[model samples]
Target: MILAKKKQRDFHQLSTPWNVVFNLFAGIFAFLCVFPFLFVVIISLTDEGTLAREGYRLIPSEWSFEAYKYVFQTGDTLLRSYGVTIFVTVVGTIISLLFIAFYSYAISRKSFKYRNFFSFFAFFTMLFNGGLVPTYIVVTQLLGLKDTIWSLILPLAVNAFYIMILRTFYSTSVPDAIIESGKIDGAGEFGTFIRLVLPLSLPGLATIALFSTLGYWNDWFNALLYIDNPNLVPLQSMLMRIETNLQFILQNSQNSSLGLEALRNMPQDTSRMAMVVLATGPIIFAYPFFQRYFIQGLTVGAVKE
Candidate 1:
C-alpha cells in the first residue's frame, strides 16, 4: 500500500513539470499564430490617416470603419460574390466529402479484389499529371466546362492526398468484426458503410470537411482562369479585382483629372487588411466547431487498432 502511494506521488511530481512546460509552449505557439490576425483586425479598424502617419499599432489612437464602409458601399456586387462563393463552398464541400468517403472506403476493404489496382491508380495521380495546358484544353475544349460553376466544382472535388488519408483511417479505425457481423445480419455493402463506417469515422470526415471548406473559400485562381462572367466571380476573385483597379487608378493618376484625388483618397492599406478580415471572418467561427475533430483526425492511420 505504501509503495503504491509513493509510486502515485512520484508520478504526479514528475508529470507536474512536464505539464507546466507544455502549457508554456502551447501558450507561446498559440499567441504567435493568432497575433498576426489580431494585428490585421487592429489595422483594419485604424483610421487611414493615422495608419499612414503613425504606422500600425496594437491600440490605435483613432478608429474608423471607413474601410468597411467603402467595401459595403458597393454591397450589391460584394453580396453577389458572397452568394457565389457560399454556393460553391457548400456544394463543393458536400460532393467532395461524399466522393472521398466512398472512394476511400471502397479501396480500404480487404474483400475488394481490385483494391490494390485502384490504390495504385489513385497514387499514380499524385506522382504525375498531364500538366496545365493539356488540362485546360480538356476542361475548356473537350468537357466545355469553362465559364460555368461546374468548372470550379469538378476540378477540385477529388484530391489524392485526402483520399489516401481517408482510406488509411477507414482501414485502421473500422473493425472487420463489425463488417462481418453486418454481413451476417443481411446488411448490404452500402447500408453497412452508411450505418456503421461513417459514424465511426466522424473525426476524419470533419477534418477533411474543414480542409475542403478553406480550399473552396480561398480559391480565386480557378475563377480567374476559367470564369469570364462577372456574375460568377467568387469573393476572393472580386477582392483581387478591387485591388487591381486601385493599382490601375494609381498608375494612371497623371492621365485623368480625378486620378490624383483617387490616388490620394484610396483606402489602400486599411482596405487590404479589411479584406483579409472579411474573407477569414466566417472561417474563424468555423474552426472552433471543427477543433474537436481536427486533433482526432490528424491521428488517422497513425495508430493501428
Candidate 2:
C-alpha cells in the first residue's frame, strides 16, 4: 500500500507540472489564433474617420455602420457576386468530389490491376508540372477555357492531396468483406461504388467537399489570370478589384461632390478592412457546418494503415 501510494504521488507530481505547461501553451496559442479575427471585427465596426485619426485599436473609439452600408447600398453587385460564389462552390465541390471519389475508389481496390500505374500517373503531376506558360496555353488555347467560369472550376477541381486522403480513408476504413458482399448481391461495379462505397465514405467526402468549396469561394487567381468579364467575376475577384483599385469606388462615387483625388484620399484603409470582412464572410459563416467532418476526416485519414 505504501509503494502504491508513493507511485501515485510521483505520477501526480509529474502530471501536474506537465498539465500546467500544456494549459499555459494552449491558452497562449488560442489567444494568438483568435486575436487577429477579433481585431478585424472590431475594425470593421469602427468609424472610418475615427480609424484614420486614431489608427487601429482592439476597441473602437467610434462605432459606425457606414462601411457595411456602403457595401450594401446598391445590394445588386453583392447579391450577384454571392450568387457567383455559391454557384462555383456548389458545382466545383460536386465535380471535384465525384472525380476524386471515383478515382480514389478505383485506386483503393486491390483487384484493380492498374491501380498503382494510375496512382503514379496522378501523383507524377504533383512533383513535376508543365510550367506556367505551357499550362496557361493549354488551358486558354487548347481547352479554350479563357474568359469563362469553367476556367476557375476546371483547373482546381482535382487536388492530389485530397485524392490521396480519400484513397487512404477507403483503403483503411472500408472492409474488403463489404465489397465482396456487394459483389455477391449482384451489384454492378459502378452501382456498388455509388450505392455502398459513397454512403460509407460520407465523412471523407464531406471533408473534401468543404475544402474544395472553400477553394472555389476564395479563388481569385483563376479570375485574375483568365477571366476579364466583370459579369463572370467571383466574389473574391470582385472584392480584390474593389479593394486594390480605388477606381471602382471613384467611378461609382460620381454623384458625390468629392473629386477623384479626394475620394482616393478618403479613409480607404478602413474600407479595405471592411472589404476583407465582406470577402471572407460567407466561408466563415459556412465553416461551422462542416467543421466537425473536417476534423474527423483529417484525423482518420492521417493515421497509417
Candidate 3:
C-alpha cells in the first residue's frame, strides 16, 4: 500500500517542464497552420480602398462583402459548376478507390499467378509513360470520353504510386490466417474480399479516398483538356475562367481613364482571396474525417509478427 501510494505520488508532479514547453510549441505551430486561412478570410472582407492603401492586416481598417458578392453574382453558372465539381469529386473518388483497392488486393495475394507481372506492370508506369499526345489520342479518339464526366474520372483512376501503397498495405496489415479463415468459412474470392478483406483495410481505403477526393476536387487540368462545354466545367475551371475574364475586363477597362477604378470598384486582390476560400473550404472539412484512418495507414508495416 505504501509503495502503491508512493508510485501514484511520483506520477503527480506535473510530469516535467518539457511538457509545458512541448505544449507551447504545439500551440504556436497550430496557430501558424491556421493563420494563413484566417488572414485570407480577413483580406477577403477588407474594403478595396482600405486594402490598397494599408495592405493586408490581421485587423483591417474597414470591411466589406464586395469580394464574396462579386463571386456570387452569377448564381446559376456558379451552381451548375458546383454541381459538376461535386459529381466529379464524389464519383471520381469512388471509382478511383474501387479500382485501386481491387488491383492492389489482387496483386498482394500470394496465390495470384501473375502477381509479379502485375506488380511490374504497375511499377513500370511509374518510370515511363506513353506521352501526352498518345494519352490525348487514347482519351479523345480511342475512349471517346471527351467532354463527358468519365473523362475526369478514368484518366486519374489508376495511379501507380497509389496502387503500390495499398498493395504494400495489404501484404503487411492483413495476415495470411485471416484469408485461411475466410476460406474455411466457405466464402468465395469476391465475397471474402468484400466482407473480410475490406473491413480490415479501412485505414488504407480511407487514406486513398482522401487523396483521390482532393485530387478530383482540385483537378482543373482535366476539365481544361476534355471539357469544352461551359456547363460541364468544374468549379476550379470556372474560377480559372473567371480570373481570365477578370483580367480581360481589367485590361480593356484600362483603355478608359475611369474604367478599372469604376465598375463599383471591383476587388481584384480580394476576389482572388475569396476564390481560394471558396475552392478550398469544403475540401478542408474532409480532412478531419479521414485523419484517423490516414494516420493508421501511414504507420502500417511498422510492426511485424
Candidate 4:
C-alpha cells in the first residue's frame, strides 16, 4: 500500500508540471493566432480620422460604420461579386472533390490493374508541369475557356498533393474486408463505390472539401488572368481593384485639383480592413464544421502501414 501510494505521488508530480506547461503554451499560441484577426476587426470599426491620428488600437477612441458604408455605397457590385464567389466556391469544390475522390479511390484498390500506372501519372505531375505561358495558351487559345467560369474551375480542379493525401487515407483507413463484403453481397463496382466506399471516406472528403473551398474562395489570380468582365469578378478580385484604385488616388493626390477631395473622403485605411473582413468572414464560419474531419483525416493519412 505504501509503495502504491508513492508511485501515484510520482505520477501526479510529473503530470502536474507537464499539464501546466502544455496549457500555457497552447494558450499563448491561440492568442497569437487570434489577435491579428481581432485587431483587424477592431480597426475596421474604428473611426478613420481617429485611426489616422492615433494609429491602431485594440480599443478605439471612436467607432464608425463609414468604411462599410463606403464599401456598400454601390451594393449591387458587391452583391454580384458575392454571388460569383459563392457560386465558384461551391461548384468548384464539388467538382474537385468528385474527381479527386474518384481518382484516389481507383488507385487505392489493389485489384485495379492500372493502379500503379495511374498513381505514377498523378505523382509525376507534382515533379514537373508545363510552363505557365503554355498552360495559359492551352486554357485560352485551344480550350477557349478564357473569360469564362470554366477557366477558374478547370485549371484548379485537381491538386496532385491532395490526391496523394486522399489516396493514403483510403489505403490506411478503408478495410479490404468491407470491400470484399460489398462484392459478396452482389453489389456492382459502381454501386459498391458509391454506397460503401464513399460513405466510409467522409472525413477524408470533408478535409479535401475544406481545402478546395478555401482555394476557390481566395482565388483572384485566376480571375485576373482569364476574366475581363466586371460582372464576373469574384470578391477577391474586386477587393484587389479597390486596393489598387485607392493606391492610385493616394499616389497622385498632388497631381490633380480633385485629388485632395478624393483623399479626404476615401476611407483608405478602415476600408481596406473592412474589405478583408467582408472577404474572410463567411469562410471563417466554415472552419468549425470541418475542424473535426480535418483532424481525423490528417491523422489517419499521416500514419500509413
Q: What TM-score against the true fold does each predicted structure earn?
A: 0.90, 0.80, 0.91, 0.89
Off by over 4 Å in 4: 1-28, 298-305
> For candidate 2, lDDT tens digit of each residue in 107-211?
999999999998998899889989889989999999999998899899999988888889998999888988998999999899888788877788888888888
Residue 288 alpha-carbon offset, candidate 4, angstroms: 1.6
Answer with 1 or 4, whichever has the higher lDDT: 4
RMSD after Cα superposition, model 2: 5.0
Tens-place lDDT per residue, model 3, 1-305, is: 99998988888666669789889999999999999998998999999889989988889879999999998987888889889989988998998999999999999999999999999999999999999889999999999999898998899987999999999989989998999899999999999999889998999899889889999999999889999988898999999988897888787896786775654478889999999999998899989999898787777777653
Q: Is candidate 2 or candidate 3 better by TM-score?
A: 3
Candidate 1, superposed: residue stretches over 4 Å from native: 1-6, 9-25, 298-305
lDDT of each: 0.90, 0.83, 0.90, 0.91
**Residue pairs that clash (backbone atoms under 3 angstroms), model 4:** none
Error of 2 at 303 (Å): 14
Clashing pairs in 1: none
Q: Which one wins by TM-score: 1 or 2?
A: 1
On a 0 to 100 scale, what is the lDDT of residue 219 in model 4? 98
TM-score of 1: 0.90
Q: For residues 42-130, write the lDDT of model 4, one tens digit per residue.
A: 99999999999999998888999989998887679999999999999999999999999999999999999999999999999999999
- Top model number, TM-score: 3
